[model samples]
Target chain A: MTSGDESRPVTEEELHAHADGLLPDGRRAAVEQYLAAHPEEAARVEGWMRITASLHDTFDEVLDEPVPARLSGLRPPSRLWPRLAAAAALLLAGLAGWWLRGALPGGDAYREAMLPHRAAVAHAVYSPEVRHPVEVGSDQEAHLVAWLSKRLGTTLRVPRLGPLGYDLLGGRLLPGDRGPVAQFMYADPAGKRLTLYVARAESGETGTAFRFSQEGAVGVFYWVDRSMGYALSAELPRAELLRVADAVYAQIEKVPG
Target chain B: MSDRDRIVELIPRLRRYARALSGGRGEADDLVQDTLARAFDKLHLWRPERDLRVWLFSVMHNLHVDQGRARRARPEVPMGGEALLAPASGGPGDVLERQRLIRALEWLPAPQKQVLLLVALEQLSYDEVARALGIPVGTVMSRLSRARATLRALLAGDGRAPTLEVVR
Candidate 1:
C-alpha cells in the first residue's frame, strides 16, 4: 500500500477531507480527540477558524459597497480603429474584382506590427506540451542564453522561475518579422505552460506600458523594456498572466544591460 | 430585472464568498471582479430560474483554479522580508494570527480550500456546493468532512486526526 494508505504525517488530502467535513463519525471523532490531546494541532484548527471569521469580517462588508458605475450599465468607449476597420471591410466587399493594392498606407507595417499577434497564436498552440514542451531545457541555461542572444542581437537573460513552482523547460528560436525570435516556455507542476517571446524592439522608444490584447481563447501581454520587446501569451486567466508578467518583469529588471 | 441587475445584486455575496475562498481581502475582491466580468459576458447562458449567486460562485471557483494553474507556470522572486511572527496566545492574537491563517489556507490544495470555504464560511448546503463544484453530493460531503478534520488538526497543532464528526 502507498504511504497515503498508512497515513503517517497528515496528507494534504486528509487535511482537505477534514476541512471539508467528510470524515466518517468514527474517523472524525478520532481526529477531534487527537486534536484535543495535541494543543498545537488544535491551535492550527483555531487559526483556520479565525481565518474563516476574518474573511467574513473583511468581505461581508463589500456586499454593502455600491457597485461601481462603470460595471453597472456603462458601455465601454468605442475606439476609432474598429470603426475604420468595419468600414474598410464593408468597402472591400463591394470592390471584390479590383485588387486594392495599398488600400491603407500602413497596411504592410500594420501586418508587420501584428507579429506579436501571430506569435500569440503560436504560443497558444504549443504551450500545453507535457514532455517536449520546450526545445531547450533550462538545464542548458548558458547555451540557451548564448544562442538566443546571438540570434536576436540583444543580450537575453533566462528568468529564474523557482518561486512560481516552475523551472525553465528551455526555449526555442522561432521566425519573426525582423528575423528569428526566442520563445522561452515555463511549466508548473500542474503542467500549465506560459510562453515568453523575446524579440528586438521595433524602431521606437521602448515604452514601459501594460497592454492587454486577445485573440480567440488566448491572451497576449506585450511590453517593451529598453530595446527588447517581450510578449507573454497563455490561455490562463488574465490576472494569473499579469502575475507571471510581474515575475518576468522583476527578473528581467535584475539583468544588467 | 435584467441579468446585469441581478448579477450586480449578487456582488456582495460574491465578494464574501470570494474573500472566504481566498482567505484574504485583496485576492478575494480580485476574484469577485473576475467572476462578475465572466458572468456578465456569459449572461445569455444563465438560466433565470437557477440561483444566480451559486452560478456566480462556480465562475469564481473556476477562475481561481485557472489562476492557480497560471501562477504555477512562472515563479516569482521570494519576498522573505521579515514580518513579525505571532506570539503564542490562547485567544485570537493580532493581525499576525490572520496572516498565519491565510498562509495555512494557502497550504491546502485548491479543491479542499474551495470546499471548506463554500460549506463552512458561505454556509452553502451540500447540494449547493456539489452543484457549484460540479462534483457529486457524496463527494462534496466527503471533501467537506476531510477539509474540516484537516483544519481542526492544523488549528489544534496536533498531527493527530480530529475525533469530532462534523454534522452538516
Candidate 2:
C-alpha cells in the first residue's frame, strides 16, 4: 500500500511490472532507483523474479515431452511458444509475506502479531469452505505431513485429537509472518471446525508465554515453544478452547519439535 | 496448413498448458481431448485473420471455465486435491525449487494462474494474454501481479498450497 498512488515515485503495479519485465525500458531506471532505496521492496522484487525464472525452468521443457497419441491429429496445435522466456537469471528466493501485509507501517510486535491474525484469517477463510477445505486431506496424512514439513523446513506432527471428539481434517500451507505457515484443521462430528496454525518461531525468542487473542468470534491461543510457534483457533468457549490448546501443546511437545 | 492440420501440430503445446492447468495427467489429457473435440466442432466459427493458436487457447479456456462451473454445481463429492502431484522430472539442478514452482502455479487461483501461464510460459504480452483470455490488458496486469505475489510468497518460503475440483 505504500506507493499505490500513481503520483508516487513508483507504484505497486510498477514494481510488479518491472519484476515481470513488463515495465517499459523508459521507466526502468526510476524503478531501479526506487528499489535501491527500499530494501524490502527490492527483496520482494527479487522474490518475484526468482518465481518467474523457476517457472521457466520447470515448465519450459514441457514442450519436449512426448505428445500422447490421443491428442494427436485431433485438433490444431498451439504450436511453438514464441519466446523461450530468457533474461531473468536470479540467485535468491528472498523472504516473503511482508508483501501480504503490503507496505503497511508496523513495528516488531505488530509483525509478530501477524501469526495469530493470519491463523484466525486462514481459519475464517477456509473453515466455512466445504468443497476445498484443505490442500491435502487426512486420508493422505503421511503425504500431507511430508509435503508441509518439507516446505516449512521443520518436522511437524498433526496432533491426534480423536479422543477429544475432534478429528483431523487436513492441513494447508499459508502465507504468514517471516515465512510460510502451516494450518492443520479439525472438525467435530457436528461439523464445527477448528484450526491449529504453526510457524517457525522467530529466532532469539523461545518458550514464550502463552497468549490468547480473540479475532472476532474466533478465540486463538498462541504460544512459542522451542523453534516453533503454535496457534489453535476456534469459535468456542475460552475454557473449552484452552483444553484443546493444552492438549495440542502437550501432544506437540512430545515430538521434540 | 489447414486450420485442422495446424491444430493437430499444436496439440502438444495445448497438452503442456493442460498439464499445468489441471495438474493430473489423466485429467489434463481429458481436458485437451475435450478441447480438441470442441475445436473441431466449432471450426467454422473461427475467423481467418485471428491467430489460430490464441483462438484455440480461448477454446480451451472456455472449456476449462465450463468444467469448473459444472464441478461447482455437483457439491456432493468435495474436491479432494488429489490432482496436485508435482511432476517428477528434470536433472539434479533446481529440482526442488522447480517442483515447488510447478506446485505453486497449480495452487494459484484459476484467473491468476491463467494470466501468468499465458504470459510467462506462452510468452504472450499483456495485450496478447488479454486477447486470449478475453480480459482487458489492465485486468491482465492485475491478475499477473496477484499471481506474481502469490508465487513470490509460495516460492520464497516453499509454500505451495494448491486447490482443485472435478465432476467425477
Candidate 3:
C-alpha cells in the first residue's frame, strides 16, 4: 500500500469518503488501515454502508415501474404543428374559463368552493405521515408564524387547541395556486391528526360563513375571512369536526390587529 | 437513437427520482409530467454540448423549485402506509425497521434530502449533484454528511424525543 501520509491521522471527512467508496487509490489503503486499527470506527462505518444498502434495496425497484403514460404523453419537439395546436387549445380554455366566470354563481364563492377541495387534498396528502407532519414543530411556533407570515405576505397565527385536546404539532409552508400556503397540523393524544390550511384570499373574495365538504373519510370546514382563506380538515364526523373548526375560527379571528 | 428517444429512455430514472423527491406516487407522477412537458417545450433552449441527463435533471429541479415557490411548500403527501408495511417476505421487525427508516428520511430538511438523494440514491457524483442543485460541491459534501449523521441519530433513537405508544 502506498502510504504517502502515514504520520497524519485520517480525518472524519476522509472516513466518510472511504465509506462512500469515493476515496482515491492512495487514500483508500490508508483508510483501511485506520479502520483496521479501530474496531469501533469500523462498526460505525459498517452501519453507514448498511444504511445505503438498505436504501438501495428498498427503492431500486422503483426504477423498474413502468413510466406513467401521462408523463410521456407529450409529442416530441419535432411535432411543431401538434404543439401549436395544444398551445391554442390552452389559450381557448383560458378564454372559456374567464367567460364562464360571470355566468357562474358569484365568482368569489366558486374560488371559495375550491379551497375546501384543496384542504381535503392536502389533508389526504399529509395526515397519514408516520413522521414529518410539520415543517416547524410546536417548539418553534413563534418562528413558524413569523416565517409563514413573511412568505404569505400576511400576518399569520397558530390557533391554540389545548381545550379541544389537540395540541399544535407544527406547520409547513406549501405552494398554493396563487401564492404561498401555510398548513398547521395538530394531533390528539390518540394520534388522530387534523390540519389547517391557510392562504391569502384573492382581492374581493369575502365570506364569514363556514362551508363544509366531505371526501371519503375526511371532512373539511372552509371559509374566507376578508383576506385569508382557512380550511380545517380532519377525519372526524361532520359535527365533531365542526366543533373543532369553530374553536379554530374563534382563536384565529382574535389575532391581534 | 435520437435525443428524443434518449429522453424517453431516461424517463424511468426521472420517475424514480421524482418518487423519492415527492414521497407520494400521485405527486411524483405530477412532477414527472410537469418536468417532461416543460423539457419538451424548452427543448430548443438546450445546448447540445451539455450532458442531456444533467440538463434534464436541472430542468426538473428548477421546475420543482418553481412549483414549491408558487405553492410555497414541499409535497405534503404521506406515503401509503399499507403498501410499505406489507413487504410480504420481510419479518415484522424488518418491516418496522424499514418504516422507521422511511420516517427518518422524511424528516430530513429539503436541501439535505435533495443532496443525499442525488448522491446516495441516484449515485450521482458530487460534481453532478452540485451542478444539478446549482450549489457548490462543497455544499453537497457538507449536506450529505449532515444528512447521514442526522439519519443515524434518528434511527439510533437519539435525536428525536420518544413518544408513548397510543393504544387503540
- What Cα-based lDDT does every candidate model obtain? 0.64, 0.73, 0.74
Q: For residues A99-177, what per-residue lDDT tens digits would candidate 3 score against the true structure?
A: 5665353465456556776666667666665436788889998899999999998888888898999999999998888
Q: Candidate 1: misplaced stretches above 4 Å?
A: A1-55, A58-257, B23-27, B67-93, B159-168
Q: Regarding lDDT, does 2 or 3 come out ahead?
A: 3
Clashing pairs in 3: A125-B77, A173-B73, A174-B71, A174-B72, A174-B73, A175-B71, A175-B72, A175-B73, A176-B71
| Candidate that beats the other on TM-score, 1 or 3, i.e. the better one | 3
- Per-residue CA lDDT of model 1 for B1-168, tens digit only, reads 766666777766777666656565666666776676677667779887777877877888788778883133221212331122223354454555556555545545567777777876676767788888889977886676566555545444443332323211
- Candidate 2, residues A25-120, lDDT tens digits: the string is 767777888889899999888877766666667665767888765566343322211111110110010013334545343656555666676677
Error of 2 at A202 (Å): 91
Clashes of each: 57, 9, 9
- Chain B TM-score by candidate, in order shown: 0.74, 0.78, 0.78
TM-score of each: 0.40, 0.47, 0.51
> Could you give candidate 3's per-residue lDDT for residues B1-168 as a string of tens digits?
877778888888888777777677898778777777778778788888877888888888898888782234532323443233233345324767666667666766677777777777777877888888899988988888787776665555532432211100
lDDT of 1 by residue, A1-257 (tens): 13342334444344434544655453565566567778877665665555566556544565677655323422211123333444355334323312344334345445333545655755754564433567777888899989989999888888877797766889999887768889998877655677889887777747558677665466778788886788888778999888888888888988877
What TM-score should be assigned to candidate 2?
0.47
RMSD of 3: 17.2
